[model samples]
Target: MSVVSMLTPGISMNSFEATAHVVTQLEVQRVSYMLVGALSSNAYGIPRATKDADIVVSFDSIGVVEFAKSLGVGFKLDRQMRMETITNSIRNIITYTPTNFDIELFRLSQDEHHKERFQRRQRRWLEEIKREAWIPSAEDVVIQKLRWKRRKDLDDAENILAVRAKKLDWDYLNHWTMIHNTNDLLKQLRDECPNLDVLDEE
Candidate 1:
């Protein structure tokens, strides 16, 4: 797992502003997307220090290359589009490196149910001074994270489970886990962290 270091001292611009600029670009481009990952969760009042922004877009033909270029993201496209391509069905993850932060673009799976979940995303204006836009709902975050099924993502889910254990919708999580065939992972989580409550059964 890649353990990206946290921010250091004296960085002029905070990640929130940088992320907002990217969001503004996406908005200007009319891309149908929703913020996710650390930034989104943090924006939702989780308060995690995030160094990058992840925006999950529709898996259809969105012309993301043009969108990225329009934002002046300074990315070099591969002629074959191996690193970033349009033909692939799975969500494409493209990274944009600006000065202080790197933004990730996720082309979410083209599932109507999943897409609807994306539509259900709610933006919360977190903090008066920060004015950070984040998706505050825990159900959505946990659902998406479970779908991702990456090792780090699982760890993040566990951490979130640790924090929001008492409040999580265990029935929903369990149902989704069964649908996604990740009940083993839940079992593993429960095994490793016997004390940390996750599902409603606990």
Candidate 2:
């Protein structure tokens, strides 16, 4: 189902409303997208507060400026898009005026893992946004977080490992980690988390 159809208007405050607004616009344009970043981690890991919303979109039907314009008032799309070094993907930023919240729209990249994760995204009900949205799988979240390797990302990876160790597919996680040269990091994070008996067999 389209994200727009699942949304109930006025269900949240400014920050959440801003995210829902973006999701609504993406659905209206028929763009394929999946929510990522802290929100995605919160689903499989520990929940936390974040001022920004990250979404990876397969945007092609329209130009960024036109798409921004279509978002209507209270949203300003940055004209200067950036290239993310790790994934080598372009990202567009949007400022939701009311709450000063930034919504990051990343263009889906050609990376093998990026493609795999996007395809593997799962639909889940997000209480914060008061709607169902697509989010990365637990394994994918760990892989991507390790690849990013930021302090916060590592912390998130550790939490997800702690929460979903046994349920995660180690083979799939191992495969991507090997390809990305992040196997050692993944192993380290896994080692740090307690009660990961599932890693013993793998």
Q: Estimate each model's TM-score.
A: 0.64, 0.90
User: TM-score for model 1?
Assistant: 0.64
Tell me how far the alpha carbon of residue 155 in candidate 1 is from the true structure, in angstroms, after superposition.
2.3
Clashes of 1: 2
Q: Give the runs in model 1 whose Cα sits over 4 Å from its true position.
A: 1-16, 43-51, 59-62, 73-101, 126-129, 132-136, 187-202
User: Please, what are the lDDT tens digits per residue for candidate 1 over residues 88-190?
Assistant: 3334333433454556665655564366567677766545214434353566676666677777666666666666677777887777678767767766764
Those runs of model 2 whose alpha carbons end farther than 4 Å from true positions after fitting are 5-13, 196-202
| Residue pairs of candidate 1 with colliding backbone atoms | 44-136, 91-107
Candidate 1 local distance difference test against the native: 0.55
Q: Mind giving the per-residue lDDT tens digits that candidate 2 earns over 1-202?
A: 4456443434444887778777877878888899999989988877889979999999787767888887767778988989999898899999877678999999999988899999999999887887888888989999999999999999999988888887889999999999999999999988788676643232
- Candidate 1: 10-residue stretch with minimal lDDT: 1-10
